[model samples]
Target: MIKYIEKLVKKLKTSEKGQGMVEYALIIAFVAAIAIVALNNGLGQAVKDAFTGASNMVTSASNAAGTWATHKDT
Candidate 1:
């Protein structure tokens, strides 16, 4: 049984076909960890607030433009 395990470990160590997949898995895990940390530290809320502020500004600008167009037509 020990010999079989040793042979398996040796085979795995020498194999290269699945190396790219392993690297991608590691990168994805790292990114996930960073996202979790950022969200936990309030970065997520900050991003949300930024987007909301931008949206509000856009809406205000649109309404102002519409009001101006109505006044000009009258």
Candidate 2:
């Protein structure tokens, strides 16, 4: 049993599988970072535009509601 345990420890210490997995993980992380940066640079304006449109819609709706409320009470 001791010899078997020693062999297992040696195997674990010499394994290169973990290193390959770590390399893959790093590559994926780098790709994800690049994607985020690209989106920030490329799509940032589009996102801002969308938010502005939404704000305009909200303002219009509020104004309509106010007009209706004022007229209903008269």
Q: TM per model?
A: 0.84, 0.53
Point out the worst 10-residue segment of candidate 1 by lDDT: 10-19
Pairs that collide, model 2: none
Say which candidate scores most in lDDT: 1
What tens-digit string does per-residue lDDT give for candidate 2 at 1-74? Answer: 99999999999999986898899999999999987997889687888899999999999999999999999999
Instruction: Go through the candidates in order and give the clash count of each.
Output: 0, 0
lDDT of 1 by residue, 1-74 (tens): 99999999999899898899999999999999999999999999999999999999999999999999999999
Model 2 alpha-carbon miss at residue 18, Å: 9.7
Weakest ten-residue segment in model 2 by summed lDDT:
38-47
* Stretches of model 2 off by over 4 angstroms after superposition: 1-35
Error of 1 at 55 (Å): 0.6
